[model samples]
Target: MSDDAQTPTPMPTPNDCDLPRRRSDFATFAEAIDYAARSEKGLNFHDMRGTLERVYPYSEMRADAMKAARQFAAMGIAKGDRVALVAETGAEFAALFCGCIYAGAWPVPLPLPTGFGGKEGYIEQLSVQLDSSDPKILIYPAEIAEMAGAAAERQGCEGQSWEDFSERPDPETDLPEADPQDICYLQYSSGSTRFPTGVAVTHEALLHNLYGHASGVNLGENDRVVSWLPWYHDMGLVGCFLSPIANQASVDYIRTEHFARRPLAWLDLISRNQGNTLSYSPTFGYDICARRISSQSNVAERLDLSRWRTAGNGADMIRPDVMQNFVNAFAGAGFRASAFTPSYGLAEATLAVTVMPPGEGIRVELVEEERLSGRPRDLSRPARYRAIVNCGRPLPGMEVEIRGEDDNPRGDHQIGKVWCRGKSVMHSYFRNEEATDDCLVANADGEVWLDTGDMGYMADGYLFIVGRAKDMIIINGKNHWPQDIEWAVEQLPGFNHGDIAAFSVETDNGEEAPAVLVHCRVSEPEERIKLRNQIADKVRGVTGMNCVVELVPPRSLPRTSSGKLSRAKAKKLYLSGEIQPLDLAA
Candidate 1:
């Protein structure tokens, strides 16, 4: 065994000694009110104006939540009743969520889904999801109330717009008390590829995870996060919103749509607000910064970011160049490389699996590609291409193991399945028992590990993620499959047969750039040129990336022994330049 493998790392656990538990102490969401009440600054909601609008002082938010709780109780929402929320981020979403907790109901937060191919496509996808979960009540914005009401009617459930729901008087009823084990919220996965799975989180689980994260990351009342991540995503919901609330901190939010339209607005918001701690979009946002940072005269000089710490990099591949570009661009603004925290997490793990400890700085390990691909190779020799950026170590209370095909632990630098188990692992996938059992597993020792379905290894104490065990392509923060893109391209003429294989090739651009590769089979030289240009255009239309299309001869494409288009194998071949590339006119 190597020295690296022999090293034992300490796990993160709640400082129960510093803050021991008490039975009378609040364990569940019902107790969250008391928790907020104990805080000095009180609960605040910062609106788009950057004004500190007090929605509820700790006492007020609690009172409103209690009022809403009474109304929910009168409406016959019992404990465990799943309530879906489809509103944007605001005091309403927060209050509704807390109200659900006070009423002992489960709040299911759904991002206002839009931007599909068309309205019909959006409605279809929304209908499919509604059928899957089958929540009893749907709360949405007044503008989309009719749509939600119609959808709920179709699903045989009750639906009310936030306008009407908030109008009901506070009922004179006793709110149900909740235990620590009671479910708090159902956080649905982004569903970038397939149907979103609702991850059930208990009150104890959420509180423990939030407390662990806030303290471990050094977030406190003094910290302020400038966020554009959608409130529906785990990072935005749990990390930015809930974590800040738990710590009595403040956050400034930019609507995801507004940020998308003007990425520069995100930086401007941060600058204007003097946000001290925050997150980011991937290289795409870095590209936006590279474009605007130079044009905006003395912007960094104007913005005070010296207090800004813990700028987490995740929700997509972490591109080293992007981080470097961001740091270099804003170095004048007081952004430190030490503040860049490249983390590993998933919705299933309640948004955090492992966080690089603050102030450790970012670390990358360049390993031999052959060794990483499961073949034995010289470990000491510097490889032509290597994986970069070790994503620090796992969080406390979490155990990570790299196992080979036989489920035995693999040595350092050997790529295998990344498995983890801890208090943060979600309870189960709502309504999908088989998937819940398959992904969430218990070993003989009785520790339940969630199969991350990602392939990587640990070096020293840091965890490095390589690729997905599943054929999922993550662009930006969204996951897509080559098939999803391929299906979109097959709609174009001259590209119908097993003519194309779409896969992501790792780039030196750090982790953010998952270069999209389209291998299309074309016959004649002229046809190949035309087909390459045509395919790139089609893919860009669908995926919003300048897709690199390489035209090759029919049957030249690599495949598995079973004749399946192996994306992993194709990516390997592309990196090695084994496949022929038909020249296209530039």
Candidate 2:
């Protein structure tokens, strides 16, 4: 294991970064990089200790990518062939991704374990993706080469290091011509082992989203992106890496593992950068940063977030309290609440679906609980409300709709399944026609729409997500969003995200009832019972149903590759008797 396992190494920006403006005018990623090659500033890499590991300019990156393209051609890899890459936030991976584009092959960015899962776990996960992608070539960093090799061997695919992939000469023939409809890459949605749905995005769809994203955020001449998001994810790959190239702007990079150890390094990079900064993170990311720096004093003096024009929150439900905590903790350093840009998106739409316009900050709307659940408010009972923050309007080319069960659009404040239609929407789930037909629907006017599988409402054209529709618990015909239950239990003392998984469990009597799996740190029998009872009470109060709370050991719940708690996996594990409850008597 590397020392980065213990201590954080901060990645600093290079001196050569000239901070360019949005010079976007391209049809495909290959064209975008070819244009970027003319610029001095491009992708850069930094170590965990704030050191500039590599300053790979766009020109050099393009050259390196071409060399990789030659290697692919030499190996008889045809255009449109799948090439699996274990995405490591480095210049090498960036170049390889571009190389796939220039070579006319579809690059599949797979996740590299960052200590969340052990070696065997990572290999298991990698092998699944390898089989799904069915790539002829596999390239990974030296750090995880053994695991990568194991996965490759299992899949009967050839593997090599990034160095080996790029060390060869240029191909004899000219690079293949790329069309706007050519596939840029494959992004696997959550659930690798159980259900790997690889979304196939085209150059036209991706570029359209990038243009809409720039216009959606009102991107300016001086705006620059600073990110530590894993490239395997859409936000990290499309939003940070490809968008910067298409827009001709320079971006700073750091490994996600480094950011995990020292989240403050994220803000530090933002604070130190002189250009207008744009960054994004999930809700827990902000929560973790605030709590990590709580014990330190003079944070204001040490940090300079005044230039952070847009701090985006997405990839999960935006937590208002966590956002407020971040603002309160950093207000002394000139961080404003208005800097927050709450947005809603998923990989199926190729990243940006909706974005908060510049200067809107966040607007929390308190809708009646009944109205939220598609029921009229009962004047006879005290009306309850849920605080949902506005996720702004759809991007320029994207359309967001709140559709009810009948597949018709719902009115304002009526919660329903969220659907989207746009130029950026993916063509289909690669090689899975049945899954594609299930979600991708065509309208009467011949427009294709994507079923986001998310439950949310619309107010004044803004979207407010409640939770996943599949995760919603139904008891006695009324809809109970598991997010509400999990959130209510989160309000309990010492509880946090991933500590609880709420789902509907079938009873022996053939009735579906809400059940909660909570991680209990307290080993004392009495305290465990007390905690479980308290959780059940809180859940019952919010969900209007009695919940069976099962206490398990801490860190027992399953999480997705991106580190989001996987309720589906947890439910499967619990039902299979895999997650044994902590020994305790009733």
Candidate 3:
């Protein structure tokens, strides 16, 4: 046979039916990995074009992790020490993260440089996180050595590429013993409206959340996962990475950057999977994929989505219209509407708070504008409503509550701050006692409840998120969600999601009013003026007040590391005159 014919076909690890599944029941993550290593399933890394490049079985990963643990011990990486690692979607990161747990060290997964930010911006971002995490050493892929090294040096931490670190002598050494209550890892909050804070999660909390997540999703023998979510985020780390090791399931992964470049390649990977697939993304992921296909394209000929059992939506607000557009775009290709699974969660909760039950799809309720705004209905005005998606019930060991400003529990259909109490909730914000106390409160029974700073209501036991509590704009004692204003502007011709940011600003008269910053693509001076007037009118129609409107250059709005608009940062930059708005006259 010729060389091409002689080469073997690449295959991913098998999801064996003979092996019994465990829902992260182990006391420690190290133990979980130890047990999972007995199985053949693990992570499969893919290229940008949806082609499998490496098949890393659990058995091999465990072996690599053991070596990494020995190396860490030789380097004096003791128990409870934080070791920061840039979360690249590959086998090296997987091995290093597991090795940290095996060595009894707490792994801190940091974000890679985002597309919008230059090297200096990324270094600054990394430096901030490094200062907060205070890791003993920073390990990253060699590609970003210069940038990562600069950040590490600025933070006064040791920095080395994983490639070089792996070459060090790793004599067999005894790893430190771990307890169920020992700190497992530090997850940075991915909030779009606030600075990232490291949330400390214990082994007990991590396992509890993972077990609840597996049960909530009804993880089965035949189910496989395909994903492109960044590992720095909780949903990708705890849900896709760590959960798979504990639950003994195989996965296929494409880098988040790769998915951004060619989003449909994610679906192409799902189509190639023979078994039932579980994939997830934020609402924008689906929106982008749908937008990539033209009305004239035959999706049925290019894709087969009938085997996709769970299409999870989380890590951002779930948009029902976006979900509908996806269904409309791919329904002919056997994509079932029932595959849409909406969920609610945060990093402070260790990951999942509520997961929609399998096969329910997206369920929405028509919440009136008055109810959402917490204002009396204006009877003279025609009733307007917003469709809020049901984010599903709490996990098995999780408890959900809606609390008002008085800290008293609210009844169903009353909007309030959403609170959850569970073993899965994060132990504390790392070394930030004041910030931790601000969110975690103790009740009469001495049970600590997490004050999830999200505004939502429960209806018939289903949670419906309204908006962020901090992002609420109160003008003249009336509450208005920034989403309402942004959505209103989006309805105007030629705008897209995340194209507008709305926040409260102090007016010239010393009164608080809503200000909108829009990303304008029109360059003509006259058209820019017209567009500004159009946006101002749209905002007035929605908020019932004249507001400040500024049209900015395209791609000027700040985004969080996870690619969500950072409204708080945008406001700060705009107020500081850093994010200059376009001069319509010029």
Per-candidate TM-scores read 0.75, 0.93, 0.98
lDDT of 3: 0.90
lDDT tens digits, residue span 1-586, model 2: 8765754443433323454554355788788898878777677676675555677788888988888888888888888899999889988888888888989999999988855457887898889888888899899998778999999999999989877766666657677999999888999876422257789999999989999988888777667788889999888998999988888777888899898888888888788788888898888888988888788889888999999989998887787988998988889888988989998888899998898888899889877777666555657767777788889899887889989889999898888889999889998888888888988999999889999888888888888888787776777788777777788899999987668898999998888899999988898889988888898889878766777889998888887656678889889889999888887674
Which one is best on TM-score? Answer: 3
Better of 2 and 3 by TM-score: 3
Task: Give stretches of model 1 more than 4 Å off.
Answer: 1-26, 40-56, 191-194, 272-276, 280-287, 375-383, 472-501, 504-586
For candidate 1, the per-residue lDDT at 502 reads 76
After superposition, the stretches of candidate 2 with alpha carbons farther than 4 Å from their true spots are 1-23, 114-117, 167-170, 191-195, 375-381
- Backbone clash count for every predicted candidate, in the order shown: 10, 5, 0
Q: What is candidate 1's lDDT per residue for 426-531, written digit by digit as tens?
A: 8888888987998888889987888888778888877897656676666565544454466566667654324467776545655533344455545567876776
lDDT of 2: 0.83
- Clashing residue pairs, candidate 3? none
Q: What are the lDDT figures for the candidates, one per model?
A: 0.66, 0.83, 0.90
Report the alpha-carbon TM-score of model 2 versus the true structure.
0.93
Determine which window of 10 residues in candidate 2 has minimal summed lDDT.
8-17
